[model samples]
Target chain A: MGKVVILGDKAINDGVSAHEEQVSNLDALHGLVNEDLKAVNRVILERMESPVALISQLAGHIIASGGKRLRPMLTLSTAKMCGYTGRRHIDLAACVEFIHTATLLHDDVVDESDLRRGNATANAVWGNKPSVLVGDFLFSRAFQLSVADGSLQVLDILANTSATLAEGEVMQLVTSNDTETSEDAYLEVITAKTAALFASACRLGGLVAERPSQEQDALASFGLNLGIAYQLVDDALDYSAAEKDLGKSIGDDFRDGKITLPVLLAFRRGSLQEREFWKRTMENGEQNENDFSLALNLITKHNSLDDSFDRARHYGSVAKDALGLFKDGPEKHALQDVVNFCINRAH
Target chain B: MGKVVILGDKAINDGVSAHEEQVSNLDALHGLVNEDLKAVNRVILERMESPVALISQLAGHIIASGGKRLRPMLTLSTAKMCGYTGRRHIDLAACVEFIHTATLLHDDVVDESDLRRGNATANAVWGNKPSVLVGDFLFSRAFQLSVADGSLQVLDILANTSATLAEGEVMQLVTSNDTETSEDAYLEVITAKTAALFASACRLGGLVAERPSQEQDALASFGLNLGIAYQLVDDALDYSAAEKDLGKSIGDDFRDGKITLPVLLAFRRGSLQEREFWKRTMENGEQNENDFSLALNLITKHNSLDDSFDRARHYGSVAKDALGLFKDGPEKHALQDVVNFCINRAH
Candidate 1:
């Protein structure tokens, strides 16, 4: 396990040679928390049902669409690592997934997205109205589960996280189509929109286990940094990864005029001609058949993908360090490997 | 006050001629809870603010658009009528209005409405994405307030109501564009989507006042009945009211193919030609400019409008009767007059 940690750090520094050894598969991690994950899946399936057939159909479409249930896995894994042996973590984990799924449903509508996780989005399949309404239903169900857990602390974390998530989304909307968006502004958006839920999900582990505040904060930091790294890799992968690996088309952000970190980095470092090219394609929404390939060339020429990957690795290291307080165990080892998995997956 | 009760019943039986004398104004009722309503408004304005400019702008545009704050007023009036006093009711009342406003924001997007309260809808002005995101923000804020109020019962009621609201919306979607939608199905939609919030809002008053179960149930009954009456009038008014009076263009539901009570009643009673008209205009979405007036004529010819009003009156009577447990006072009288106001306003 210790050698695995060194191999993870070495792969980050050396770049791609040790791919098989460094990139940890989720299978082992899932095996550790498989029981709780199944329970969480059951709760998700049970709660998604409604007397209104459209709701279950729309919600079931998205929930069953199989993007790795990463957020809930975080909750279940962290809970087990913190010595939480009870069933409350199962429900809480389901709540985390619900919040994540609700946002995805709305995000697809907001982004006017056609496909998600390699499947037609709810908005694409059923249209926008059911998507919006069922998203609201999933959100309410998430809160109901939080309340049923009967923890004010849990409720506070989730309520605040929900608000932050919305705020992050609004920030992204404001920042979209603007090439002048700053890295700091981008970080703020990702932290609020993505990392806040991750933080809350991990904190739920320590919260339910009655761990000390220090332990809870450590867990939150672990999830927060990991989430940031995960999103950074995702943003980078949008410009570079194969469609099958990404579960969606490459260059989606570019086509949609979304100003992600890769674009921001490449735009910052671009020559004057390259900047104008970005301005034409992104800001003015002008594009030709070859615009996507040209954008990729600009990103690669500027080495923005490597720069983004490096930043992701830094956050990944922080995430790994945050788990140092936990004693060595299978759960802790699996969680540490998750940080490796996040960063190395792009390789 | 006693004469007003008989006037309400007679107005229901005799129809529009007695409207001027029978229908009570809301000014007196608003006056009864004026201070609390003011406090609720303050909370609303304060909470709508966010560091994100778009959130406040979109939320403020809708929140300040001047719909009668009737739902919040119910919370205030019921709490006062229940013989209790506290500042908590003010926050809870604001929470009710937030929930209502949040739904309206999403509702306009789902229904593709351009006008609300005689002003452009938030969706119409800012586009659908902002409307959807801000609606989610306001919903989260409402739950934040509910959690702050620290009442498990309040949380339970609100959490359940939010889910039911979404469920109701999905039900409407499922039943939309289908002229065969049953009266019973329409009732279920209205009950869950519209009446459930009213019930929760009114029940909040008793819950906060620590009133007995009977009083709480009565308040819930009062609100449920009033909400039914209110929505029925709204459904009827879509065919009959002027744009200025309703604060939205008439025939919106007709254009959207929404199957409200009047449509159901008229469809059931229509001749084969009339039924064909409904099927073409509503189910087939083949609406012409003159179709609205023609539908109105068909509704009037069949007395479907009057019959729907009669059903609304029945609910108004139930709402009025629910106040029997309360000792008569200004608060009680104002509430009873609200029932009159609801029934008579359709004229």
Candidate 2:
């Protein structure tokens, strides 16, 4: 027991109180894993510090912005579920979160987003250049962290995931305005951009644990599915989530010309008029809230939202099935809970 | 013996006739570094190829817009100079070029200019989103290339340089609208953003060659000095360069409210009216090409251009002096040529 985890259940619950049952589930696991959680928190804080003053400031802003810190939690929980007894897991966990934060910062800048996590985005507050550069800084730091354990395998996992993430971002950037974006294309983009990193997080935990090869594969698969589920839910919430809950305007993605799965499905299923509405708003970047609501109406009429939810549920089930490959443990159960939480969450 | 030394008296003159110089350097280096250079080229092209058609199209657009691949050439030259026989130097060389290109793409977007390398910039053809995302993609690919070497030292060198580059960009972004940028601060920013990577390129070459520690230090120092001289000359050219020769618009930096070394010196030495003039134009981004002549007048009267030239010469001399640590050879002489070329170029 070289590392300790001091779970911040109270803090997380305070932020996510509306889902009291979900919070309770997380809290119970936090209590059980509390002894080992502190190491993760320490790794994150220490690794986020940089010689660059601007990076230090913006990295602090993002880290202290009070999101769920879910990716790191997944890494930690996966390692514990695998019955790991190593300190490297903390580094791996922090590395995952750093990768996530780096992407978030860059994404906000790319989206020219003003709000996230119920606060002004780093770009909105500090400016886009700092957000982009500090994102690069965090990414470099994450690479350093990934190599800390001298695991070439971990490096390979992260390096591939990082490249995939960038590729997905480029793909999304390209297709953001193209009316031809299909459901499959949207899935491919999100899986690469979002799910790939999440999958890497889980895979890295298994690697740190030195779990059996079979279990490691299962964990990675579980992570991949959960990531897909999580992103689908996010896409769904884009249409339904309030500005307060989502931290950005409703249809913000559409406004930014991002064609997510729900919209893609709706476009495919909609009549000529509905398709025209999407093209006019998203492709031309001409939509206001009124057009956005009309588009939502078309999505509902076509049951496109339902189709996206079905896919999310499918991925969620697959994610849980991945945990069945692991032996019964609090960590495994927590992983399962995460999968459920991803698909079911409103925001 | 494994890597070719591609050098000739006419190689630099090949810029006026791309065909003549292309044959000299690429073929000569290819013959000598055929084995390693091929691997390097492979890494670059392979990583650059995308399953998504649009990204690959955009990447091809920027990559095909030729510039003198000076930084990679240094890597190849130094690796051979230090007697490295391994193939890894090739990949490392290409990685340096990738990083350089990525920065150029992003800089163009942030600066919002149209021309580069005597042709269209990525942003000009594809828009800012593609340019930004592709820049990120190239960066990610460069890191992947670095990781392939499995050297933590190489990773650290590249990672630290990447961070420095980002920090430099942020610093520049912050001071872009300010007229009070000191020459020292200008140097500091360029050293981090531009020189650091050049130094890292040479250092990576030394690492590849596994040269003695002192020689490695000398190579890195040489690169830093040469890179600083290179950028200082570049900044000076913003005022003195012919529009056709410079590719980018003359005084484009001033138009973007960037306070480079000469401009900073000019502002400091100018009278109160001149200071007010600078504040309205360079600080407020109110200047036009009509103001270029006046700005040039201020620069010349204050001898700011001369001062900038002197600073460049100092860096060039330091760079040439650092070559004393290398063994006497044609490669060393060629390296010296780079320093002279950087400091003495008209454009």
**Which candidate comes out best when scored by TM-score?**
1
TM-score of each: 0.93, 0.90
Predicted complex 1: CAPRI docking category: high
Give the Cα lDDT of each candidate: 0.85, 0.77
Residue B340, candidate 1: alpha-carbon lDDT: 77
Cα miss at B147, model 1 (Å)?
0.6
Badly placed stretches (over 4 Å) of model 1 are A1-24, A241-248, B1-24, B241-248
Interface RMSD of 2: 1.7
Q: Enumerate residue pairs that collide in model 1.
A: none
Candidate 1 lDDT over residue span B159-188, tens digit each: 999999999999999999999999999999
Q: What would the per-residue lDDT of candidate 2 be over residues B232-286, giving only the tens digit for each residue?
A: 9888877773432423357778778888988899898889999999999977777
Error of 2 at A104 (Å): 1.4
Q: Scoring each candidate complex against the real one, what DockQ results?
A: 0.80, 0.54
